[model samples]
Target: MLYGNRSTMSALSRMTEGNRLAQCFLFYGDKGLGKKTLAKWFAQRLLCSGTGEKPCGVCKNCRTVQKNVHPDVIWVPHSGKLQGFSVETVRDICSQAIVAPNSGDKKLYIFADCDRMDTRAQNILLKIIEEPPAFTYFIFTAGSRQTLLPTVISRLVPFAVSACTEDETLTALRELGWPDADAQEAVAAFHGNIGCCISFLEDDNVKLLVSLTKEVVRCIIDKREYDLLKVFFSVSNDRNSALWLLHDLEMVFRDAVTFRLGQDIPSISCDPVGAGMLAGKLSTAKGQYFHKCIGKAHDAIAANVNLQLVMSALCAELMSGK
Candidate 1:
């Protein structure tokens, strides 16, 4: 069940209503915003045999897409430590693009996590994406557009997927059989990010990283560079964990900027108190610099820079401001 982003869904539905949809679409947003979920629903909307309110959930096409078994709806396979599509994989997709769909209406290619798709694979795909075959569609989901090459992005229609409200998240969890209290706790931990909420509940690694993130934020606020470095070194082994850590740390920094601006908005930070401390001490210029450092750290991880080295360099970069 889709949680939120009703506005995004409505806009997409309207596009299909006009039959003016693009051949390629990119759903980009922060992780756990359900970009892939929205992408699948969009596929159902295109393929649904129902009368109105596409993806009529009960339709034959909708069920098949839900099951990922629809002949015309191909979920592209990805592999590698970063879970990227390889050059060979993109080549195979290029070959498959020439074939007609089994259903004769539309053939959809779903690339769920395109955040790590290397430039080589993207370059290999540029020509086909530029001039896709009739009835062939490509949909990509990524954490951000910065991950994709500019040429590839120019050809794909971009849509930003947003997280639902905390209330909506609670409703989604309750529907999934979680008790009200547990649902509330999950919502508190991750706000409207149901995916991360579920992870916080089920994954020890996520729990550890979330806690470590709070500590890292506190260290940053207090200008404890040694403690910050220790925290990074402690979680240096796992690339995904480091990325998650960076994301959370970045959110806290974002929260600090907002706090400094006197904006009391919904926060994405793990440690709001520590974020407040940062707001009090750091100037706006310093805050933007902090954000830049975090972004560079994210870029390094995506570029497959060595995990320990990335962490070490990030520690140095972030503390350099102090």
Candidate 2:
């Protein structure tokens, strides 16, 4: 019972009625908006010998297709680090599309991350896409259709997968065993990307944040010196998203500090342990001091200050015996 976009499901249902289940479709959307999920589901439907709309999810062909072992269904990832389909890959795909299906009515090829494709590879794709085999279905996914060539664009039916509404996103999270408060925070933190929310939930860094934030707050309350540079360097993964992770960490810490000092903790961190740990370390003056340092640290980090220096200053400011 995987979730699906309601709008997309309706449009697809209409397409099934219109008999425009063309040989090719271009699915466009932001990352983690379930383009690949829907593509795979559609592939299963096409491969199924079932009587109705959905693949029976029980037939031999459907099971194999769901497990990604179907001979007639090919899933191609962007070949390069920057995320684009390769010319060689496109040629390979075309070669496969022409072959008859081993056990189904159609041979389905899904190209993920088509936005990374260069002009040459796209041109290669455009040729076969212009006159695809009657039994072949080519589904390409891109971040946006603007990245695709007009020639390629005109050959396929475009399917736009939009981000789910906040309520829909929250409901999905709640179904994943998250409490209402935690689900709300995860929705905001991941901007409604279920995969990213799951990533955050499973992150080792979050586990560390639970303990480390408590220890840092204890130091602040008891007036002991702590080193920020070591913590900062340990947390940042040498990527652009590192900053985002840091911001999220700081929010959790602030919530914990408030909870520790008998203040209402903002229900913004998904980790319950983190909230409880901070709650155990309450002191009025200490909480205020720590909150001020958090603001300063965020400002320094945002200004692109040297990471080590920012960490050092932040640690010194928050630690009591410094």
Identify the leading candidate in terms of TM-score.
1
lDDT of each: 0.86, 0.67
Task: Estimate the overall C-alpha local distance difference test score of candidate 2.
Answer: 0.67
Model 1, 125-214: lDDT tens per residue? 999999898789899999888889999999998999887888888889889888999887778768889888878777889888888988
What TM-score does prediction 1 earn?
0.91
Question: How close is every model to the real structure, measured as TM-score?
Answer: 0.91, 0.63
Error of 1 at 172 (Å): 1.7
Candidate 1 residue-wise lDDT at 288: 77
lDDT of 2 by residue, 1-322 (tens): 3465767766665554445456788899755678888887777777777776566888777888888999888888666545567788878887877888887667888887776578898887877888888788888888689878998899989988866666777888888788888776667655556755655566756445544554544454455564444555665544334344445556566666667655763345444455466556645455556666776676466445676676666666666422
Off by over 4 Å in 1: 18-20, 320-322
lDDT of 2 at 177: 83
